[model samples]
Target chain A: MDLVERIRSGNKRTLSKLITEVEYDTETGREALRELYKYTGNAHVVGITGSPGVGKSTLVARIVKELRKREISVGVVAVDPSSPFTGGAILGDRIRMQELACDPEVFIRSVSSSAGTVGRTTKNIIRVLDAAGKDVIVIETIGAGQVDLDVLNVADTKVIVLMPESGDEIQMIKAGLLEIGDVYVINKADLENAARTKSQLSLAIKERDGWIPEIVMTIATSGEGVEKLVDAIFAHKKHLEDSSNLRKGRLEAVKSEVVEILVEKLKMRFYEKFSNARYSDIFEQVLDKELDPFTAAELIEKEEGL
Target chain B: MKKGKNIRVLIAKPGLDGHDRGAKVLARACRDAGMEVIYTGIRQSPEQIVETALQEDVDVIGLSILSGAHMSIIPRILELLNESGIGDIPVIVGGIIPPDDVEELKRRGVKAIFGPGSSVNEIVEFIKSIT
Candidate 1:
């Protein structure tokens, strides 16, 4: 059988293979997704994002365990940063989630954000998991860059995880994280100043028009206060379902996906049409101050009929 | 084989082994060689390794087992890879392996064996050649 059939039949290997194809952005992968798109739109996409060393992975493991207790199948896409110099990544999230390795109901995959546009490859991987019949699909991004916030577009429920002593209140606000979070989690709450951090976060977060973002304190190591966080997630899910918010979120996600694909295709077409020699000539003119970049770009667009 | 494409490699430590210094070093070596490396941490099961390899669509599977469980672990991974129809993906073994078991592992479809003192350059070159 083809990859789509194998994935629909619950073949974890084929599911993984198809995800790899999508991650690499191959034609075969695109064709496979085209065939498997019909099986999607069933899984609840959750985005768990936080800064480095904030125990996002540990929290994810706890959430997966709690989700498994409910007999809900889960698929995790742990995104790790790739070295700009080497294009390599050490995907260590699986270390914290090793307990789920043997659990057939849980499928965990690690992806490198260096593959392409940030969160673009991850969104595609989530689609594969969704097509594979997962009840809940969680995407854990490398919460290091501003680009990581792009995950908000793909996840229906955006869970922004923070530690008590993260000490980046101003940085979080600047990163636009305060605007994207649907649920705020103060993880590693057992640390010092946990309450202070929680209060500060609450003060920083402005109330939404309809949904007030719930802040849950969690000690992921010992699984303390995790159930409440899960409850908050379920509550958000229920809220989305109760309102037309779920449909609206889906429409927004589709729009983002379409725009991303279009931009990528346009970039490829632009590069293909303009050779390096032409680019070098343009750069030379810019370097010699013969033509400004804006004028050069306009000239190229007019000449190429782009 | 596009220009400047990364050759993704999954450097995994399967079985009940906790010695990961060698795995981490090798993972870095592969990374420094300009290949995308996914290190699976330590004490991973064969099922997890195979699943990760399939998911990563890695060009190679590097097993770092110092627990002397290579006899039991490597074969299980090979079997799983074949069962999953990804047997064509080469499997390379590293770490402390007795001289007697090296030939046996090779016969069992291990692409290459790197014992103690093996240079990282050699391993990276071998992977590049095969891939």
Candidate 2:
């Protein structure tokens, strides 16, 4: 059978291969996705993101363990940042979730965020998991500060994991995480000042648009309060479904995906047009101080009939 | 396409060995050499190794076995990789393999073996050359 057929039949190997294809943006991967796109939209996509060392990976591993107890088939997309100098990543998230590695019902894949847009690759991988019949798909983003709101566009439920010692509540608010988090978590709650941080987060989360985001405190290492966090996630899922918010979220996701694809296509077209001898000639002219970038761009536009 | 895309390698330790200093060092070396390294932690089963390798879609699988179980574990991994239809992907073994076991491992589809004090640069270069 072909890749699409194998993926639809719940083949983990094919699902993985297709995910790699999409992650690398290969032609075969694109064709596979085009064929399998129609099989998507069934799984609930959840994005778990937070600052580094807040125990995001540990929390996700605990959540996946709890999810399995409820007989949920999960697909985890763990994203790790690539080294800027080396283009290499440690991808240590799977180590935390190693218990789930041998579980047939649980599929975990680690991806490097260096593959262009983390959000786009994440969404595409979620689609592959959905096509493979996972009931819940979790996207764990690179915990690199506050620039990771891209997860907001790819998940049905956006969860931001934070710690009690994550610093001043005002800083969290300023980071704009308060606005995007559908469910907030105070992980490492065993640390001192847990209650104080919870209260501060509670005050910061005031009711928004009729949906109040719940703050759940968790000691991920011991799996403390993970059950309540799971409950909050289910409650949020129910709220989205009951209030028809799911439809709105799906529409936004589709819109963002379209924009991402369009931007990538335009970039590819621009590179294809300029990656020849003409590009080198322009570079040499710029290096010799014979042409400014702006003038060179205008000349190229005119010459290319743009 | 970019000149050289990221080379993904899965550094897995199978069996009950907890000695990961060598594995960690190799992972860092590969990362420094500009390859994505996915460390599977310690004491992983062959099933877990093969499954993780397939899911990660790694270009190379580096097995770190400090115990004297390379004879048993290496073949299991190779068999599983072949069964999974991904045997073409190179499998490199590291850690205490007897010199007598080297030819046998290579014959059983083990690509390369890096023993004690083996150069990390050599491992990186081998991966680059093979993949």
Candidate 3:
């Protein structure tokens, strides 16, 4: 059977192989993804982002458990940083999720942040899992920074997890993180100033599209308040459902995905075309200031008739 | 065979061994060598290790055990991998296996074994050569 059919038939091994194909960006992977694209849009993608050591993975593990209790099948994509120098990643998020391993209802894949994004290929990975028949897919970003809001484009529910007494609440308000989160979680609530952090978040969070973001406290290690966090996620999902926001968001995501693919292809093509020794004269021209970068680029474009 | 393909390896600690320092160092070394290493942390069961390897579709599986349980745990891991139909993914064992057991492990389908005093370069070179 073909990969798409095998994935549809719930063959875990085939599903995994396809994911690897897609992760590695192979042509076969692209073909399989195109075939499986029609089967997507069924899974609810929940993106969890936070700084390192904020219990994002622990919270994700708890959320997956809560989801399973409700009879929902889950797929988790846990992203960890690849070394800038070595292009290697530890991907230790599964360490906190050992209990979920034996559960056939859950499928977890660890991804390396290879292309510099928090969750590179995350949108495509979500589609693969969605096609494989997961009910909900969770994307755990690699300890996001203020501007690492790529999750905003893929996740239906954007959850920004933070810890108490970390003073990140103030930092979040000034950045794109505040604008993207559909739900806010102050995990490690047992730490001091939990209420203060929550109140700070509440005060800064404004209503968007008639849906007010909810801040739920969670102690993810003990699974405390995770159920409430899951409820908040569902509530946000429902809010998107009752409104036209879900369709609109999906449309926007689709547009962004297409544009990103186009840009990436153009970049690769540009490098491939210009890296040859034949382009040395063009480089010399630029180095000698015979032409400005913009005009030189135009010349290259015109020479290629692009 | 794609240009962008990366060798994905699952670095697991089987049984109750908590001495993951070697595993972690090797994971870093693998990454530094431009491979994606999935470290499942310490105290993982054989079932958990197999499941992770399958799900991740890793090209290699590196087992790090210090509890002197490689004899018992490694076989169960191999058995589970075969049952899962991913037995072809090479299994490389590290961490305190005596030289006598090395031959036995290789006979049992362990691709390679790295004991103490083994350089990171040697291990990395071995993985790159194989995968």
Candidate 4:
């Protein structure tokens, strides 16, 4: 009857409303998140990250189909970058995943990477989906660049999707994607030189936690080799569980989440405190060369006990 | 405790209409207006549209149909939205539609209809007002 009850009962509208509340970071949303926390940690959160045009969305769609075939309920959180100037975005990932959109068991939410707080919001969204009882929640990151490794902390199974002939072996290693992936998905493997890419990836990927990352070749368009990718995901999940590494990974995730929250709160507090007329004296001092910026910052911190 | 929320709108082209120039223009306008626009490219079924609206939890739905199938396609989209329990989210159509059918579509619960030559600013302002 209540919000949590309705969400648990799989009321799509209520679930959607809750997600909106969460996105807005409202008081009710925070309350619901706290309430939902007890029911979280059930879904296997999968992060699908790759460069633009690497078929991350299509691969996610295919992966969800494969998951649904096994009667697993899915939640997809597709992230797209917001326009930095206008604070808007065109979340077009659903164009590829429309077939599964109508599925009663699958829920897809597009997230705009707004305000640089995408990592935190995504964590909460996954919590909502997990509490709602989705068996697997896939998070497709924004067309990522090298060093955009935020997905590393949010996902339990990190799936780095790449394409054949995308780059040479050294270029792939320089991208640092080889380090974070639990499973490597070379989507569009039907293209030329896939074998070379696979071998190249195999050489660069080092064994971590006694579980070597699996490279699964996939042509996500035709759903070729997706089942193997799914199998690889599950195998990695099993490896984590049997090795008791899942608990360890969750500990790291929680630690990062807490730190992220703290950093955001501190940033807001700092802005609220310093962005005022009262701080003009300090700014003037720094600008007039009567005080250095670092000393001025320390003075403010000491005076405000910040 | 935050109150500000991003307006999320789904702009889609339904039926056999491959002409998406208008739709793309509208989507760009909405985005520039600071609304997150989910643009599902041309030729989407009513089911796909409604399903996307529900999944994305969009504040509004804008249909761009140039195929003159508003009578059939729009109603089906509304019906599917109702069936999906998200009929409350407003649906607006923008494309080639006769003036006579505009009132008819409105009578059938379409929030608004924008025919050809409709200014992008007008449509954007209308969406901003409604959402």
Q: Which candidate leads in DockQ?
A: 4
* TM-score of the A-chain for all models: 0.93, 0.88, 0.93, 0.94
Superior by lDDT: candidate 3 or candidate 4: 4
Instruction: Give the Å error, residue A144, model 2.
Output: 1.4
How many Å off is the CA of B124 in candidate 2?
Answer: 1.1
RMSD, every candidate, angstroms: 2.7, 3.1, 2.5, 2.1
Model 1 lDDT tens row, A118-224 = 56777788888898889999889898775577755688899999998787567555647877788999988888999988888887887664889999999999999
- Docking quality class, candidate 1: medium
Which residue pairs in model 3 clash with each other? none
Q: What TM-score does each of the candidates earn?
A: 0.91, 0.91, 0.92, 0.94
RMSD of 3: 2.5
Superposed by TM-score, candidate 2 places the C-alpha of residue A59 at a distance from the truth, in angstroms, of: 1.1
Instruction: List lDDT for all candidates, in order.
Output: 0.85, 0.87, 0.86, 0.88
Cα miss at B78, model 3 (Å)?
A: 0.9
> Best-fitting candidate, measured by TM-score?
4
Give the DockQ (2 decimals) of all models.
Answer: 0.53, 0.67, 0.71, 0.76
Residue-level lDDT for B43 in candidate 1 = 77
lDDT of 3 by residue, A1-306 (tens): 877788987788998888877877778888998899999999999989888999998899999999999999999998887777667777889989988988998999998777654444677888889998999999898775522476545789999888887776557478567777899999999998899888888888899998999999999989999999999999999999999899998888778778977998898988887787767888888899987889888988898898
Error of 4 at A178 (Å): 1.5
